[model samples]
Target: MAKKLWVERNEDGSWDAYSDDGAHIKFGHGKGLFNPGDLMKVALAGCAALSSQFPIENALGEGKGARITVDGDYDEATDGYTAFREQVVVDAQSAGIHGDDAEKLKDRVERHIEKSCTVKHTYEVATPVTMKVKVITK
Candidate 1:
């Protein structure tokens, strides 16, 4: 199924983004709202976490999960992000998987995320974005 997503500006100048599934997020250049860059980082982190969920749960149990953090470095000269670092932390040792087992689990999770995370794959490929503008006149 094709997904539809859009953002509408509010009277207060902030924007509300909505998806076809009813997911909503408030974002703009305002306090207590996520900026565009922050959303991108969040998307990457969420995708990675989801992509590795099955491997992590299979190794550590059903309720076990990983914490994924994505940080992007903004370059003022280019007015864009220069790099993004993602960290996925899973406490396999606490689940009794130790030493070589933990390392193997980590490697497996990384490989799974690298292969399955759509957002991460997009970032690596540098997808091109095209915009179309509509002008309305009274």
Candidate 2:
């Protein structure tokens, strides 16, 4: 299925981006909304977080004290992300995951970080994007 989005330019110069699922967002400088580039950061960060979730849960199970977070640091000059800092804060005493298990956890998480996330792969490698333009007049 192909998903579509529609964007409208407001009278005040800010723009509203609408999704196919009745979702709307405003974006522009000083518009207090996320610009398109910022949204890319969001996608990368969110993908990283989601990609890491499974490994953490699989290692420790779905219980208390298994918190996973991924924050992407964006490089403004390069117009891309410089780093994605991941924090997997688990309470060792509560979760009963310790010793060699802890050692193995890092490996599992790292394996998934770069390999699993689709968006991260797209950003890392050169994926050609081509566009064609046509003008329609009434």
Candidate 3:
């Protein structure tokens, strides 16, 4: 079973997520090139790439490796929403993978990402959320 991860940020500006077994990731809000939200999209893309690996390999038996990349396009002017597009390129010399296989793999990856990715799933649903802030003078 996968370990449950718990994430926290300290007052000193450090961040980390710990699992039951102590495995975790360390990073801060401003420490990376992009924020945690951006990393969420990257993780979705990474999941797509990794999930498609098996299909690609099976389609290209004893074939050369191929590179698959997923990109997300956002429209901030329209309420900060984004669409994800995946690009997959296969080597011509590869033994099993072909144009058709690549197309099928792309579709499979798309469906998987839409349904399985945490960020994507969250974005697809509408949740009732509200925020309240109180200011105190000392």
Error of 1 at 112 (Å): 0.9
Tens digits of per-residue lDDT, candidate 3, 22-135, equal 787766666553456566666766665555555556666544334656566677687454676656565545455457865776576556555555654565677577978789
lDDT of 2 by residue, 39-75 (tens): 7766776776677777877766764334555567778
Residue pairs whose backbone atoms clash in candidate 1:
none
Report the number of the highest-TM-score candidate. Answer: 1
lDDT ranking, high to low: 1, 2, 3
Model with the higher TM-score, candidate 2 or 3: 2
Comparing 1 and 3 on TM-score, the stronger one:
1
- What is the C-alpha lDDT profile of model 1 across 55-92, one tens digit per residue? 99999889789998889899999999988999999988
- Each model's lDDT comes to 0.91, 0.73, 0.62
**Given candidate 3, what's the lDDT at residue 84?**
65
By summed lDDT, the worst window of 10 consecutive residues in model 1 runs over: 91-100
Task: List the lowest-lDDT window of 10 residues for candidate 2.
Answer: 62-71
Clash counts for the predictions, in order: 0, 0, 2
Model 1 spans with C-alpha error above 4 angstroms: none
- Tell me the TM-score of model 3: 0.55
Q: List the residue pairs that clash in candidate 2.
A: none
